[model samples]
Target: MADGMLGYGTTVRIGRGATPTWTPLALLGDIEMPDEQADEVDVTHMQSPGRRKQFIAGLLDSGELSIPMNYIPGSASDTLCKAIKTSGEQVLVEITLPVPSGETAVPEVFSGFLKGYARTAPINDKMAATATFRLSEAVEP
Candidate 1:
């Protein structure tokens, strides 16, 4: 296998409107990239010969992205996340993958709706939250 880039410098940004003005979120942890999947259709037939199951591809799912970050109430990131969830509006997400030296960066841009935002406060640990976004369309270059 070839050498792959590390996840040290990965960044996630969120924005709104037709011509979105991107702003990076002060993420505190790893970012889960979109996991694109396709649905399968099973077609079974009973013939004179042995029975077999046929399958075909159905609709494609762009998949969801889960991001973990520090929870700072009333902050811009927190407010934006809540607004998106409350309004049920689609927002733009830009994920820039880190590349090696002198290599062009790869960005995965897509439109998605904020699915969920949950915060946790532990006595021994810091306050953290997870934001989940459901992709509504194909990810662009």
Candidate 2:
């Protein structure tokens, strides 16, 4: 991963016959983020399709996803923190994937995976905003 990406880890818990199962997963490595001034963070970079899918898969595989957003400690607030303090803030990201035929149900899988991941994942000061899925496209395979 690039220095611009953030590092994260996750744990998932599943319920079985009135019992819950727990699983954990961590980022393969640290991710890089776009350089910005102190207190000016950009959460948009974290919304890539590959990242999203990997997150979802992590959740499905372990029943939990943990994303560690990169942070710079300083006197100023970053774009990410600014957006977090303000409600109704939105960012756009584009993702491309090799279109899968048949009944892959990417969206459904993504939703379920996120829900499961979010249920157990923790958000801290390092996190600027929540992860959201935007678009998916099939590339020539």
Candidate 3:
């Protein structure tokens, strides 16, 4: 049996869609898919004898994409910090997962605005940065 690929083989890339493609940026240790779900509205019928009902959906709320990476000057974290500071701007994110069949698979895609960035200063470990993005618009790839 073949062993599965390790997490280290996964890659996270980001770009602004300026050069006709996504440009890989930053060395992220971990990346996550968006946590998104459908929205609903309550429409209980008064004649239904105290039964509550919810409509299927209205709009999907904004999802989040989280990334953790080593904090370095002029690195991915730095570039993300700059992006996050911008007002009302969204960026693109792609996560590539390696296949165990000895080939590269198509990378998953997402797009969202840079929402928040947190920096950690650890005394005994490598410093890191965590970024959160508010995702929207059928951004799955």
Q: Identify the leading candidate in terms of TM-score.
A: 1
Q: What is the lDDT of residue 94 in candidate 1?
A: 88
Which digits, one per residue and each the tens of the lDDT, describe model 2 over residues 7-109? 2221211111222222222221232222222232334356665664332111112122223333333312233233323443222221122233353422111
lDDT of 1 by residue, 1-141 (tens): 567767888888987887787777776588877877889988766762366677788988998988899998888789888888999988888888888888999788888999999988899998998889999886575
Could you tell me the lDDT of residue 47 within candidate 3? 65
Tens-place lDDT digits, model 3, residues 46-92: 66555756455767775787788788867755875666557556677
Question: Which regions of candidate 1 are displaced past 4 Å?
Answer: 48-50
Estimate the TM-score of every prediction: 0.89, 0.20, 0.78
Sort the predicted structures by TM-score, highest score first: 1, 3, 2
Q: Candidate 1: lDDT of 60? A: 82
Of 1 and 2, the candidate ahead on TM-score is: 1
Error of 3 at 100 (Å): 2.3
Q: What's the candidate order when arranged by decreasing lDDT?
A: 1, 3, 2
Name the candidate, 2 or 3, with the larger lDDT value.
3
3: Cα error in model 1, Å: 2.8
* Colliding pairs, model 1: none
